[model samples]
Target: MPEYGPQPVERQLPTEEARDLLDLVREMARREVRPTVDADEEAGRFPRDTFRQLSASGLLGLPYPSEYGGGDQPYEVYLQVLEELAHASLTVGLGTSVHTLSCHALAEFGSKEQRSARLPDMLGGGTLGAYCLSEPTSGSDAASLRTKARRDGDEWVIEGTKAWITHGGIADFYTVLARTGEAGPRGITAFLVPGDAPGLTFAAPERKMGMRGSPTAQVHFDGVRLPEHNRVGEEGQGFAIALSALASGRLGIAACAVGLAQAALDEALRYLHQRRQFGRPLADFQGLHFMVADMATQIEAGRSLLLTAARLRDSGRPFARQAAMAKLHCTDAAMRVTTDAVQLLGGYGYTTDFPLERHMREAKVLQIVEGTNQIQRLVIARDLLGPEEG
Candidate 1:
């Protein structure tokens, strides 16, 4: 937004390779993502081609192991990559995150044979994925999900629906969480269902407020059959696997939030500088200057929290609390910053003439997805004051 190139995001990358990776990502964002994001999003066009390009460029599998087509990059580096992508186009950024989340069950808990057979295609074959955990009856209370999976001979017959599925109708694969045993979280089990599996159907994508470039829909499994080998983990381990995946998933949302906020801040600053008022630059107004400072400060703070949690995760430590906190703080900050950006632009912000309005809408969803801000606060509170007891 400033005349002097882009505002540099200060990062403590672990290696030269990581720095090079960021440079490459910036180039991709500038060339492939940013230029057409607004138009494509407006048209509700899924940027499948852009995702393919990212897969080809090795951007889709950054944090996973290279043995299975991943880049073997650290979580810190991977989160920064997400931030860069979100700064350009949130659809691409959040899509990449969902892809990563969908791969976790197979890559982390699947048998050696399963990973050997499935992880490669998922990580690098340009096949989009969706994680199916939320259902019509379940959102934050995923344990209460009613999706059912019954063992019928050599196959598991899955039935019920998954709501708020990213890439739902169009995903090549879905990591579905269904009830296989008792009730509650332990009864849940994860299944890898092929998109073309018989009895699998998708509702039309939701007409959402923002990030429309990514499809979100209701996925219905009507006795869809999959071989027993498709089960990702133990019969009663689905909820655990889901939680583990979410701990990491929350970090992705946090990074995307920071990126969105940064983009909003960038737009606001540029518009202020160019849109003059009362014979002076809008940016020169002391009140607006304070607002910009606050926005920038919030962005940096959120980034720091996310990276710290990422580093903890990369180092094999428990970073769930940090991830929750970061998700809570960053998404809230994005909502505030983007709304402020709209305010700074005055009436122009409300119009389609500027991207600020779209960004403001996009920022609202971040506060709800991955884990709602209320859920995040619950998590942080649980960390501070143990889980509630009966």
Candidate 2:
């Protein structure tokens, strides 16, 4: 398949800096990332080197504080950049999102001492991160995570497993949520665990259908020990911290889904223009043309919603509900647009000779990742009404 970016997005960036950032991102995506997709994804090879290059180029920490190696861009610009990257390769874009999510607790809630000591490396010192909140028994019920961390003098001994961790084995550090006091949300605490901790281990990466270039594995804490200083925020605050981080992470997923959908739409349009059907170009068919138009329209709509959510976040306003809605809408649009692209391309879309099938497969995971679409609706409904009743 010919791998190239979709048509450029007409972004409403706040500054010339943001526009330049997007330009650089598009260039990199076209030259560096697009060429590697087929081989790396097919071989299930994690693009560690590509990530290292992104880090060196300062693309990995756009939304954090510049004092600590970040680009210090607003969430609005950061998310747009994410869309560009994801349009090139979902593995790269989604991996960057997960990495940024892993940094949130410390960046937003850590002590000054912790920020001074850790944020620089976590943000841009070529370090990768993973967030550990969901256990095998608890996915959406993240507060019920079974991981336990017990105080032992100046250290904490942690045990239990975290499932579906992106960058699990290869990450440089992990932001972990564990039961520190009681049986529920209020008892959890967050900690920063080094990847090379004495007892930290990982199961084999999951055999996934798409985005296989990004490793998703089960991370086990087998009596892993962390310093007392590694704790993030106050005790009993991990659940809130996790939720806050996810609010932003949801937007990242939304942008990526929009990009994935756009890529599929772009390719489908190209094929329609070039390929003939019934002795006429597929683009000449009103039916296929309508499908293309709808796909493009939905992708644009999703992009607007996602950017609105990002702007709300940048304004320091309460945006959880908008974020959830964006995630739900964009991911669903991606699934629909990609499926439609497959239909638009007919037989070729079903084969590896084209990227529509891969986009379709990858789009499905966006609905499940960050938060499942079902959970997203619950979140939106709760915002519209009130908390779910027992």
Model 2, which residues run further than 4 Å from truth?
A: 1-6
How large an RMSD does model 2 have? Answer: 2.3
Q: Tens digit of lDDT per residue, candidate 1, span 23-84?
A: 99999999989999989999999999999999988888899999999999999999999999
Model 1 scores worst on lDDT over the 10 consecutive residues at 1-10
Give candidates' CA RMSD values in order. 1.3, 2.3
Q: List the residue pairs that clash in candidate 2.
A: none
Off by over 4 Å in 1: 1-6
TM-score for each model: 0.98, 0.97
Worst 10 residues of 2 by lDDT: 1-10
Best by lDDT: 1
Error of 2 at 124 (Å): 1.1
Q: lDDT values of the candidates?
A: 0.93, 0.92
